[model samples]
Target chain A: MEPQNAREKRDAAVEARVHLIVFRLGEEEYGVRIDQVKEVTITPEITRMPKTPSFIKGVSNIRGDIIAIMDLEERFNITSAARDSRHTYTLVMEAKDYTMGFIVKEVPQSLSLPLSSLDKAPSFVQDFNISENFIEGIGKYENRLIIVLDIFKILTSDEIMELKS
Target chain B: MKSREQEYKEIFVAEALEYYDALSRHISELEKTPEDEQILAEIFRLLHNLKANAKAIGYLVIADVSHKLETAFGMIRNKELSFSDEVVTVLFDGIDMLGELISNVDGAKEIEPSPALLRNLDIIINTQTDNNTELNKVQKYYTSKNLSLSDLIYIQIKKLDHLLNLVGELIIDRDRIVSISKELDNDDLKNVSAHLYRITEELQYSVMDARLVNVGSLFNKFPRIVRDIAVAEKKEINLEISGQDIQIDRNILQIITDSLLHLMRNAISHGIEKADVRKKNKKTPQGNIELSAQNDRDTVILRLKDDGKGIDQQEVRKAIVQKGFLNADAVSDLRDTEVLSFLFEPGFSLAKEVTEVSGRGVGLDVVKNAIDSIGGRIKVDSKKGVGTTFTLYLPTSIAVKGALLCQVEENFYAIPLMHTDSVLSLPTEKLHEVGNLLVTDIKGETITVVHMRELFNNDLDTYNGTKTALEGDVQNIIIVTYNNRKLGLIVDKLLRQQDIVIKSLSRPVNTIDIYAGVTLLGSGKVCLVLDVAAITRYFIARR
Candidate 1:
């Protein structure tokens, strides 16, 4: 009975797959857990909010609710390619009790890969000045490498509130 | 699935909190009329049930405290003992300790009642000769099963908050559709949209109304708080509360609860004089504190008045001068009311000696901040020989705010009507400079006027000395007030006055205090609501 149970556990582990919504920031591809992305739509008109950091592009009206729109490239300190604003999309994300949107130039695509395809990120990724907390791992599917992002870690729960003080 | 033990603990905690509130209310009422047998019996019954409930949950400490308390009440019911000051103090301590134990039952380790508290209860129990078996029999007859039953369900407040948010979204959509129907000028669409609008409006109000709890739910707890402070200070304070049936949004009540408690303690400690002092002043020996609420137009006024020695303006002025807040010459020029307003300044205390209850260097400024955060205003009025009264003007509901939409340059902003006093256009010549500050005179009062263009342009930088050139010959100024101070916010034009559902700016944008929150305009554009309190404070601090 023990051997049979162990075999079943191994089979279940092999069947585990991680589904991610892949989007582009600058030249690099980033993937966030599919469940974290609530919806993706064309970028709406954003009203500039004064006194906020540059990364916070502004607040926008999304389906009658005001959501703060953040420039993902600016947040990650990546030099923007200065893409046309009309062609960009806003990814509405649910992050830790808060709903926010991120602006991306390219449309996001969903992909599901087996657990075996995910691996620990290389140390050089940290050298780019992105906190290791923001990276879930590296996903290698086919010949392309996708940087699995931990959406919840991009903004710490108390980070914004702490700045207010 | 939650374990049975976990489920039981949750139920126990919720029921225990309700019992605590009910018990506190009953105990305070009992103190007021010690001979009222009905209230006494009710208290005894509640204690008995609490004891049983605690014991069944294995909260030995809570059960033991409740059992002793129940026994004392039972003896009191049998005419075995009288309600003396000592008995009152011990009874209050037991109830307070029980509250602490019940609240901590969810902790990793159980909290044991202090030895002294247990000893006090033991002394009270030992004073009785009989075990009161007859009273015990009567209590057993009136068991939990015999109590009146109500068909009610407990809801998590978080769910109500979410529903309120969804309702807010529907209201916004209803407005959007109504506007679209008007633009299209389609008869059938307009008719259908009109019907939809009414339904959405009714739904909006119903959802908000569900959250409107009686102010009494909050005001009832105060009798005990006042009792505790009155007993400790040895002052005879008769807290007369009325208009408790008036309802308010529970969220607003929660925000202002601590501020009200702080104000109450201040009244008992600082405002009210000693009994002998009152007698010397040709006043009744018992001080009176009237805490009443009344409805105003779209606002609720909570008034806390005390018939005690009113604020001594002379002492306040002296303190102001001594503290170097202002020189004697300038302080003397200020009016009596102006000097009194300084009582809310940070670290400003007139208490010669720090007492256990208050005067720990935390002044009314913290209370002012709390009120300010809720977009409410507080004003203090006192007549030196008569009394002191604090009138707080608060909005009826926080879900939607009445705001004046104004345009600054090209951006649209909404200033809450609660803070907005009036709007008028002033010619450029009316604006003058007092020293280095821009001051505009309106009705003999000089209010500092800062152009919104400059104020919003500087990111987190408060009013700088740089004076921007006025563009137009006429400047439209919106008079905004916070606390007792007022400022004139110069805007380009006033769009319209409308009810706006304020949506809090999440994350990074929330750190910006100048804007309270963002709201969606009827045109589907996001508009920021100006934080009048923050702007007024910044303007005042710069002066």
Candidate 2:
């Protein structure tokens, strides 16, 4: 018992079911670990970067922080929902080494569920025209499947390095 | 051992190493002046914690050893014992014992210094300060051996980076506030914003200062290096070093370490003539290499000057002609400095005859490329039969770069000023077409000129659709060059030059190699900082 307690204290167990913040990316619901999010903010004036792929919505100031904005619709290859660009929402997330923001259609409520409830994504779901590795699992929440996104996997090493630059 | 104990041991080792570093640094300092009450105090304070840490970790042997060393350092601090060379030597011996014992505490190696060494140290400690003659001898010996100016608590490098990132954001906001305040024109707001601006500037400077480390960290290793090289090369080489106090950003120093080492080796092996040859040339038998650094304007100037066989420019010019980089007539009109730059041309010295002709070894070009990558400049100036000096101008900080802001269409961009040699505004008639590219003469040498719209591939529909210019239309040419390849970047309008704080673009945006990083402008606009080298490479490659 003593040794078990010592080991437990040394390596604190990582919680299996992380609190996830659900958001809409062009009508489809997606969930990212809540701890990975720094804050959710209204979209500021985004400065479009030239010579970058269309998925990169460019950069914007969040509070005092300059965060790179990623267009979720373009990244997921979903046609963007017709909405006012002026009233867009930005979900500021903590990437591996830096903080960035993703332009979301709307930030829904946060949800918590057991890890057992999440099923492995179907092979057809993997056929989505995006980075397949980004989707960790498909979890049922409120009569809808929130695709649990592996926030870390969304950006490759080179992309992370480039962003951190 | 339990994993918990193992964790403790890992931390112990890291902290112990830092304490050990402090011990060596302070000891070296005491050696220089053989005095300094604060350095002594610091040494004692450092060991107290180290002793405590070792005791806590059950490494009582280390604790006992350090306790004794701490007592010695404490005695020296209070002048209870005369700070003598014998005393410092004893302390250093104690330090070495402590290092070895601490390193093996994880059961890697069960090793400790002999007990007699500690007893011998005690004997040195007990030695009375009798005669001034002996004391002076010890002091004089240390005063000669000492060379260097040398961190604190081991905060995670991630934490330091996080702090820097926060400070970077504050700097951008500060620029915004100052600009907005001017536009506001409210008396109280103006006064308050002015105060905020000053505070922000001071904070930025303080954060940058914290990140800076003395270059002496790199320079301190040179004495040993030079000594080793001198022995190996069988040459009587005298390496004189000064300016062990100049500081630079830690990151810049890390990148330059290998390149600087390469340059020194090049100087030793290829630049310096042997003692016998030196005597025949009516020079001193011992070759002299002076490594010095000084702050020139805003740039840190490091000079590695050697008294040896200077670079043969005629050979370099001949190699250039042979490489077909230039024809014979074109090479003949070039200055010595201009011709000598070809020595840094990649594969220039790879050939057997070229090495025999130029009389230099391989990889000089690698040195130049490394320097260029870091936005630093390296210049070589040599006189025939005299000697050569390789001067490197490194920026004070890489975080903040001086950039020339320009507007292409609606968006603004910043071209790093380090890449801009100069700017030219000339009529269209002066520029001529060369095959598929446009070229202009800069001091009789052909320079490829690229226009903004065309370079961007007319991505944004230029209201003026053509790449061609009207008869009297002025061309805004920013001359950017690297490794003798020059390009004239023709932008639509020249904005003001500013000391821009570079913010790295995230992920996919950063994949665009032509843009170095992003800078938040005073008007709340994020402008991309152009990587001049990349732009030149892209345009040249496109051809």
Candidate 3:
């Protein structure tokens, strides 16, 4: 019976092990799943596409492959530097069959934490949210709120089809 | 693997498609009317704009191509280069290449322009520079003429659409005053209400008028299309456009451009006979195709009339029969006008052999579909060996107001009064079943009655007791006309008529096409606006 309880405890620990990649946009801390993140790099040249949604910055060529870059400031409806040099960074992610780059204010740091740390996002987030689809959950770390993002939901299938079309 | 960068790339791809379309038209026009300085200036402006934007976005391939086009235009403007048929042809080829590049941008496959094409472009650029002496003279001439050409500003249509939507909401808010006034009884309040009403009316009218733009902007490109087709067909044709100042909604104008282009091509390729044939027929040696636009009541009537050998009824009838759209017996009964209308039927083409211009079997049918998609009707009038005039009657605006309110399943729906012909009361005894369709007689006319519940797919019986109380003594029957046929719609009641702003349903609620849009009533509750024609078509198709 003692061996059986030990096995259950091991399984529980495995379930609790969840990793998040945290990033900053202005002053806010945001986190996405570690598996969803492909890479992080300094800002690169972005080729502008005419007549795109306002949030889309343009396309970028990264390591010989063409990828689209979306302005995180615009996507999050935040007011940041229109084009800042020192604060610029690119978050490379793979979601919804697209390899895209997210232009954020700074580099992201990977964090390994227990799933029990996450809690439901406050009602205020839903009321004033620009886009709630990509948000998975929220967690508190060091007196700051980390917005967990569902990268899969951010790059939706419909958006992929729209791009293809 | 999709990333944020890929999202931006897609945006670029969508924008590139629009720019390419403009570029192609500009190039095609330049080919035929190279001497038109204004057209050349426009071309230069468009290319320069594309290059600047492409560079800003980091689209190196587009930037490179546009840069070359801009340089070529710059040389032309300077008089260093003169227009040639070969040059224009090369420009057209370049435009086509641009279109391919844009299409590839969104595709999963890697995009690379043909090496041969790039080499050819480089050679053309080098050749232009070699002839800089002539280019300098051209530039001097342009300066002497006092023509100042600048790059065009590129704005997305969505931004304009969003602005219009906000204006529409403002108009709706202005109308809400009427509902508020109904609850007040004071004399001062009455005086203020009257003033508010007048101001709101003026605001609504002016805002709507602001959205109206001259269709000529779109029509201007067609002359070049006609000229190209005429040269290819070895025919002498003169194209005339009148009433260029007639205005319509910009949204409707864009949809009509493709249809009009197809029709214009058809006229040049198939409608107009060869120069010799035209001379033999006692018509002008140069066949004339006149496109005229005018307003008739609330409808905008656009006519494309060509002085050519009219549609041969027998040939059309034969094609109709071959296509199986009509039986032999039906063909025999059809009038010449009716037979001519068969050209608009899908997959029906009378051309003996397919031509590059139009014989793709989709031209006329596409015109019909385009017109129908915007709730417009196409009418054909033809005289044997004389001419054919295709008249299109379309509503000037898709954003309709002054709707007739009707109740169905305890909910009220607004049906645009323009589409609602007449309302009649159906006596219980007169309503009889005719081949599973309820029929009612109105002044010797037999009208088919479509139950509102079934049409909207509402879960309520035709004569539910609760509906009777709301309806009162009169059994409401709305008579609506679709494609010249009258259909009687049975409703629970006829509510008060008001000018309500139409709002589009969100994607989730728009699966059913019966509701053209949704609008908020005075009480702020959302009510669906029934698209009467779409509903009729749905019923007919289902049947």
Which 10 successive residues of model 1 chain A have the least lDDT summed? A156-165
Name the candidate that leads on TM-score.
1
In angstroms, the error of model 2 at B220 is 6.4
lDDT score, residue B190, model 2?
Answer: 87
> Which clashing pairs does model 1 show?
none
Q: Write the per-residue lDDT of candidate 2 for residues A86-107, one digit (tens) a residue.
A: 5777878887767778888764
User: Candidate 3 on B293-345: residue-level lDDT in tens?
Assistant: 99976688899999888888777788877887768996786656556766765
> Tens digit of lDDT per residue, candidate 2, span B34-96?
678788788888899998988877888888888888877777776777776566666766786
User: Model 2: which residue pairs collide?
Assistant: A163-B506, A163-B507, A165-B504
lDDT of 1 at A124: 80
Q: Which stretches of candidate 3 lie over 4 Å from their true place?
A: A1-165, B1-158, B184-200, B275-282, B312-352, B373-375, B425-432, B439-447, B457-476
Q: Candidates sorted by TM-score, descending order?
A: 1, 2, 3
Q: Rate the local accuracy (lDDT) of all candidates.
A: 0.82, 0.74, 0.70
| Best-to-worst ranking by lDDT | 1, 2, 3
Question: Which ten residues in a row are the worst by lDDT in model 3 chain B?
Answer: B135-144
Candidate 1 per-residue lDDT, tens place, A105-134, comes to 888899998888999887887777567778
TM match of model 2 to true structure: 0.65
